[model samples]
Target chain A: EAEVAQSPRYKITEKSQAVAFWCDPISGHATLYWYRQILGQGPELLVQFQDESVVDDSQLPKDRFSAERLKGVDSTLKIQPAELGDSAMYLCASSSRLSYNEQFFGPGTRLTVL
Target chain B: SQQGEEDPQALSIQEGENATMNCSYKTSINNLQWYRQNSGRGLVHLILIRSNEREKHSGRLRVTLDTSKKSSSLLITASRAADTASYFCATVSDRGSTLGRLYFGRGTQLTVWP
Candidate 1:
């Protein structure tokens, strides 16, 4: 029953504003991920972290988006100057390297950019 | 740039019936995983098949992976109305820096009627 945790389950902001989402993964999970799910579409990886170090962030829009896992446990994703298209569900996932590659996902933070 | 593409965008079935979904990937994968998401909620990991595994079973769910064909199938037998959700397939690549990065498909919307 160790579930990934997310905060501020819902967020609404105007375009050009700043928004941030937080996620706490399962205990001892070494890999953490941030994903964005547009309405009616699957989640897409925005950034991945392995023990506080970024592993893959090719799909991340570095100009306006940033993510971090400072302690290698909990992570934060921020969208600065949020655009209308940034409205989506932001999800966090984690999996331990010692376990099978099955990821546990958090309830997610739904962002609405008006 | 999704690595997996799930077949049949939507499926409707009666309770107790079997539900099967297929996913095709574009590259060699270290593993393929299936996840379910209820409306407005986070994803729940359903099953994962590694590159070396062909088939796996958990309760009423049976997952088959054809690594040669870069495809995987998830079959849920004796489904219930609660099984109504969006199901997605995610792929982890065999290449560098992609082991923990999951590329996901658009997902299939399943509506199981009671």
Candidate 2:
């Protein structure tokens, strides 16, 4: 079965450094999302893309965080000058073009900032 | 803002018993879905129930949705130790726009002891 793929299963970096995570959604999926999960808390949306165009990024910290899906199939999320609070699990998910369709998620990248 | 909330933040059950988790949401939704996540792994879609449907079943899992109450419940019968994980509920709004955006709840953590 096809599954969403992500890289850098674990990342450790110091504060003020830069870090990036990559995600490749299942083939033919039209919607992609990025979420962050703090320990003991539910995942929170960071950004969403629909076929290379950002549909919602209201919660993204624009000054230090950015995400892109140039070709609409794969995506990259970057954090410049990462902070201690940036230590969390980053998750990527994708879904087909159907209202209320189920989303498939990839194994997340756990980032630890020291 | 997150649209879904789940009750019983944590639960512990014995293997072979049944486990139930409840979730409530605050908006008109086209569908409600349940997902399972092992620690440090990605979420796995378990079931989805449409606004027009009241209940759905897949294997040992049964899900119920009440649109009028904006609530849903997931029941896992004959639970096993492998079922120990975090379960979340997500809601997709009926608004035609934002078609792929899903608001998730703070998941319920279930531990099935063998």
Candidate 3:
């Protein structure tokens, strides 16, 4: 089975710095999602993309965070001037359609803002 | 808050025993899904149950949804050491949104001893 792919399994950066995470959804998957998971808590949606357009980014912090899927195949999420609370597991997931569906996930990128 | 809540934050059992985790959500949902994550890794899709469905089974995993109660349960039977992981319940709401999203619960951590 084809799975989503993410880069930089682990990242350690100091506060006030910049960092980015990347994700490539499964082939032919129409929907892609980015989530943030804090320790001992459930994952939280950061953004959602359909094809090459962003469908939802209500949860994304516009002041310091931005995400784009220009071609709709791969995406990049960036955070500038990171804060201590920004340390968490960044996850990428993909699904076939908008209807009731199961999502495929990647290994994730662990971001630690020191 | 669109987040869901999961019961039994933690559980421990011997190998071959059955583990059960329950999830409750506040809003109407199109479907409910179960996922597993090992430590800091990304989520792994387990099973999905549609709102119209009562129960569904896959291998040793069984999922049941009660729309009336706004609750769902996941059962892992004949568990093994590899089954020791954090289980989360996610829901896709019936309402329309900018982008389709899945809201996850806090999750239940299960430890299966051999």
Candidate 4:
């Protein structure tokens, strides 16, 4: 079975540095999502995209975070001037449709900010 | 912020015993899903129950949903040490436009001792 792919399995950065995470959803999956999981907490949705268009980004910090899926195939999430609290596991997931469809998740990129 | 809330923040059981977890959400939803994650890893989708359905099963996993009560439950039978992980419940709201967006709950940690 095909799975979602993510890059930079682990990353360490200075508090003021920039960092980026990449994800490639399963082929033909039209819905992609970005989530942040704090230690011991549930994953929180950061953004959602549908066919290269952003559907929801209310929880994303626009001033410091930006995500794009230019061709709707692969996506990149960038954070400028990372904060200590920004350290967490960033997970990317994809689904074929909105309703009862199951989502496949990538082995997240663990970010550690010093 | 319309996320599901899981009960019994933590659970411990011996192998061969059954484990049960419950989840409650604040709003109407199109479907509810359950996922499992080992420490510091990505989520693995387990099962999904639609709002119009009452119960569904897959292998050793059983899920029950009550739309009127806005709650869901997951039962894992014949648990094993490998079943030790954090389980989360996520919901997709009825608002069709937010197709790819999922609101996840603070997961329940399950430890099945051998």
| Prediction-by-prediction clash tally | 0, 0, 0, 0
Candidates' C-alpha lDDT: 0.91, 0.91, 0.91, 0.93
Runs in model 4 deviating more than 4 A are A98-100
Instruction: Put down candidate 3 lDDT per residue, B18-97, tens digits, no spaces.
Output: 99999999999988889999988989989989899999999999999999999999999999999999999988888885
Q: TM-score of each model's B chain?
A: 0.96, 0.96, 0.97, 0.97
Off by over 4 Å in 1: none
Residue-level lDDT tens digits of model 2 in A1-114: 999999899999999999999999999998999999887767788999999999999889999999999999899999999999999999999988863288899999999999
Top DockQ model = 1
Model 4 CAPRI rating: medium
Where is the poorest 10-residue window by lDDT in model 1 chain A? A96-105
TM-scores, one per candidate: 0.95, 0.95, 0.96, 0.96
Chain A vs native chain A, TM-score per candidate: 0.98, 0.97, 0.96, 0.96
- Tens-digit lDDT track for model 4 on A1-114? 899999999999999899999999999999999999999899998998988999899889999999999998999999998999999999999988643268789999999999
Separate DockQ for every predicted complex: 0.79, 0.71, 0.73, 0.74
Q: Model 2: which docking level applies? A: medium
Put down candidate 1 lDDT per residue, A50-112, tens digits, no spaces: 999998898999999999999999999999999999999999999999873788899999999
